[model samples]
Target: MPDSQTLGNRTRGMGEIVDIAGKTTEIAPFGNTLAELGRERPEIVGLTADMGRYSDILPFRDAHPDRFFNVGMAEQNLVLIAAGLSKVGKIAYCTTYSVFVTRRAYDFIAIACAHSMANVKIFAGMPGLLNGYGATHQATEDLNMMRGIADLTIIDPCDATELKQVVRAVADIPGTVYVRNLRGKVPVELPADYKFELGKAKVLREGNGEIGMISTGYMSARGLDAARIVQSEGHDVGLLHVGTIKPFDKKGVIEFARRHKRLIIAENHKTTGGLASLVIEALYEAGVYMPVVKIGLADSFFECGSQEYLEKKYEVDLPRFVRAIREGV
Candidate 1:
């Protein structure tokens, strides 16, 4: 296991994965995608809360210097300015640490953006246990908090392929959209031709109705790997990647759940009020009940450490996922 300093130097605050040993990685996919999109859409503008380097918005700032804005360290001002710009016809793409945006700028996002249906796309970096700064910096509950805002489109992309698609997808999506941004050397887990659609879930792998796994964010990548591992052991498993959290694919989830005997819900957030809770809510309301093993953080403030350490300590690592599927709990 690498130390925090070693992992931080390699991942640059992004989550560390033990399984992606030789997978292709993309550097600054968000910034490159925004810069490319800004060429065709002059109305698209990038803003960061003094997080250009870490948030990976510098490429946009370099490509369109005239359209980029850095609102210092004030997260509240970041959302407010993005919202203000959206009202005046420009599509605002803002970046910041997820913890600051969700915790400090909740009111601005809820009222100034979502409440008015502003075209402000918030790409929040260091979501969940990705950051080594721990609770103060990890936006583990961001989905739960942001999902409460009506009309807000919340998405937790799976990898570099999906993250790039999300940046372009949210540009045309009316109203405020919140994304759990993945920065640094993000793995290219999904297929290159994968198309991202809002409020839809993708079935990554099919099984024989024995076990099903629903996951969002980077956890989707882990779930895919775990599913394959469990399949090799003769236990059929299916993997559903739910990138969009709010406006969730209830029909897809219910349909997928109905095919499987048991379910495993995984996320990089607390088990409460996040992906696990959403899956259960949808299943119960649809009358598709089954035994579920949740893979996520506990209902407690996590301590600062490397991503590998924290994930293992909280029992959300790949091994835990594999065990959950193989053991049926």
Candidate 2:
């Protein structure tokens, strides 16, 4: 484990929430990937709500300053401008803090972008508990809020590899897309050859009908870690990484659930209206029920703290995951 000073220093300003111990990482994957894509696609435009640095969109802005627009801290205006750009035949890629986008500018997103199926791609930074700036910044319920918007495609990539893939994928996907963006030294947990498909869940590990784990966001990487730990103790554990939130892979989830006797649903957001809730709802609709453990935030606002402290205090750390796999929560 990293010391408090190390954790504090790493999470000082617009830093990552997850510990990157002994892992390969990419710096500014989102911005760099978008910049690379922007060079090829002239119709793609970038916008930010005064969060270009924090959201890691500066690379895109640097590459295409003529097309990059900074709407100065107004999330609503940001969405409206993006939607308007989309209406003008431009694929507008807008960014801001997840909490601000979902909480403050939700009406604009719902009405202007989603309602019209605009070609606006929203890259929301600091999703779930990924920020150290407390409840005001942590978008613990952004998934819940965005998933309800009709015609909105929500995605939560697990690592830098998938995040880059998603940045490219959404460009061709014609409609409103909401992505939980991971920035600043993002870990490369997925394989280099991994392909990210929209509306599909990828199975990372296979189990022997004993225990299966379903996870989204960075929790998918942690789920793989926990599955390995449980496997060492003679329990067969499987892992399914669900990158796409809305337009969820219900068939894949049902098939995975049918294979395992017990299941564990893990996510970075709240357990009530996030990934866990979606999985449970899918299982219930499919008439597949079993013992299930949910690993996520409680239905309460969190206080400002280091990612290590907050994850441990809220029981979403790696050890907590190992415990949940060993002894059902």
Candidate 3:
């Protein structure tokens, strides 16, 4: 384990979150994938609440302009319109900020989409701590809120690879699906041959007798980095990427926990009522007991700052994981 002095200095010197000004990232995956899928499936339609460009659905708009609808800034109307389209046998894929989709359109999502079992896929951008515009923009509690909506399938893909596959997988499902999205310049984390399946967890790295690091969304990238650091320091750690949130992979989670003596569950959202709670609940039901640690936001709203700054301050990054593992917390 690293000493406190070493860990503290590393934490204090963490870099702020900022986009590269010049270098181009991969063409937004969701937009490009949707555009390609739209050519094959005419029933797939795109909609956004005036966030076509921000949410990266513009490619779909350009590809199938006739099937796209921009409903201005009314989020409720955004969801309601999607429900209407779904009712008419269209697979409606709506894009918006996760904050708006989960906060402003909660009722419409619960009633119109989930209650009615509408085939509406809400691809929400800036989920969890992705945004830095204070509490109003950062949707740190969306997974908790959306999970309570009965029968709603929730997904938080790790990267471009999983996001593209998730979009296609949920399109054929019969009910409402909530996808936490990465809008512009989405990173590619998995290998080219990685295949994504709904309601399954992927074991990205294998280690034993130390920490079982399970993560979701972009945080999985951080977890993988942390695992590498732990291994370099002569400790063993494993990483299980649980991209599916609502219908969590209970069997996979149990099997992973059984292999390791301790667990560190990392996520970008609040620890309460989210992935940590789901995993704990599953372990309890299965009579599996192991010391667990959570790396995520506290039960509080974040103030305005850059996404990188907020993540560092809240201690949800790779450095935080290393420190926690060293301190045995």
Candidate 3 residue pairs in backbone clash: none
Worst lDDT 10-window in candidate 1 = 1-10
Clash pairs, model 2 backbone: none
How well does each candidate superpose onto the true structure, as a TM-score?
0.95, 0.97, 0.92
TM-score of 1: 0.95
Cα lDDT listed for each candidate: 0.88, 0.90, 0.84
Q: What is the RMSD, in Å, between candidate 2 and the native fold over all Cα? A: 1.6
Please identify which of the two predictions, 1 or 2, would achieve the higher TM-score against the true structure. Answer: 2
Write one digit per residue (lDDT tens) for candidate 3, span 130-191: 77678888888999999999989999998888899988898887799999988766666777
Instruction: State each model's C-alpha RMSD to the native.
Output: 2.4, 1.6, 4.8
Residue 190 lDDT in candidate 3: 79
Query: Model 1 residue 43 lDDT?
Result: 98
Residue-level lDDT of model 1, residues 1-329, one tens digit each, is 21233553343244433334656788888999999999999999999999888899999999999999999999999999999999999999999889999999999999999999999999999888999777788888898899899999999999999999999999999999999998887889998778898999999989888888899999998887777676667987888999999999999999999999889999999999999999999999998878999999888998777787678888988889878977777
Tell me the lDDT of model 2 at 43: 98
Ranking by lDDT: 2, 1, 3
Clashes of each: 0, 0, 0
The residue ranges of model 2 lying beyond 4 angstroms of the native Cα positions read 1-5, 8-19
Predicted candidate 2 versus true structure: per-residue lDDT over 197-230, tens digit per residue: 9999999888888889999999998888777777
